[model samples]
Target: MTVGFVAFHYPRPEDFDDFVARVHQIAGVLRSVPGCLSADCWITTDGDDAVVSTGQWESDAAFAASFAAVAAADVDVTFDERERRPRQIIKLASR
Candidate 1:
């Protein structure tokens, strides 16, 4: 089973670029972690003031450890202030 960590952020319009740049930096760090299958960031299409980041890990433990590393890095951003949650999802269904 794969694990996902979703982070939602509501950033000011003026801080959009900064937020994106910081996320890019964070993504680079995350990609280097072992067992990190994929990591992506998405913005809403309807001019919403939020961004969602999804990270897939090989296992639940891997996801937790990877995120711990990210938190320890303290990349000059306050992700803790954002809404974050871990979820387990079924990717496919058999008929």
Candidate 2:
């Protein structure tokens, strides 16, 4: 199995809740894609404007294919231009 993660940092705390909802919505879209075992959203406990999304896929190809499809769809949800980062992570030490 392959694990993927995306970390998002909001430029403005006011948009944090909305961003979390959007991330969850993205996870919902991925749930229907083939080989996507699961997707989840997480937030920090210290009330920081950060969110992380984790996804489990059968393989790297599956992950790439699904992401391509989403990109092709041209979904409109977006965050502030000043957002800190959208870090893409691959394979984070599975137990």
Candidate 3:
């Protein structure tokens, strides 16, 4: 089974560009991690302050290990004092 993680963030109105640029920078790093199958960053079309990033891993263990690295790097971002939620993990299944 492929393990996945979703991270949600809310950016400040004035920091929208900064938020997107930072996400792209992080995505590049995420793609280089070992056992990482794929990674993507997305924004909603409604012009909301929210963004979601998804990462696919080879296994649950691989996902957890990559998160440890992210945590050690203090990768969490806060915009307009909005709270950043914890990463959610899920198992991906094909149709």
**Model 1, span 11-77: residue lDDT tens:** 6777767777777777766767898887777776777756666677888777777767788886755
Off by over 4 Å in 1: 79-95
Candidate 3 residue-wise lDDT, 1-95, digit = tens: 77786776666666667777777766666666788788888887876656777788887776777766665664544434532443343455333
lDDT of 3: 0.67
* Candidate with the greatest lDDT versus the true structure: 2
After superposition, candidate 3 runs with Cα above 4 Å error:
74-95
Candidate 2 local Cα displacement, residue 77, angstroms: 5.5
- Candidate 3 TM-score versus the reference: 0.70
lDDT of each: 0.66, 0.68, 0.67
Candidate 1 accuracy as TM-score: 0.73
The alpha-carbon lDDT assigned to residue 18 of candidate 3 equals 74
Greater-TM-score candidate between 1 and 3: 1
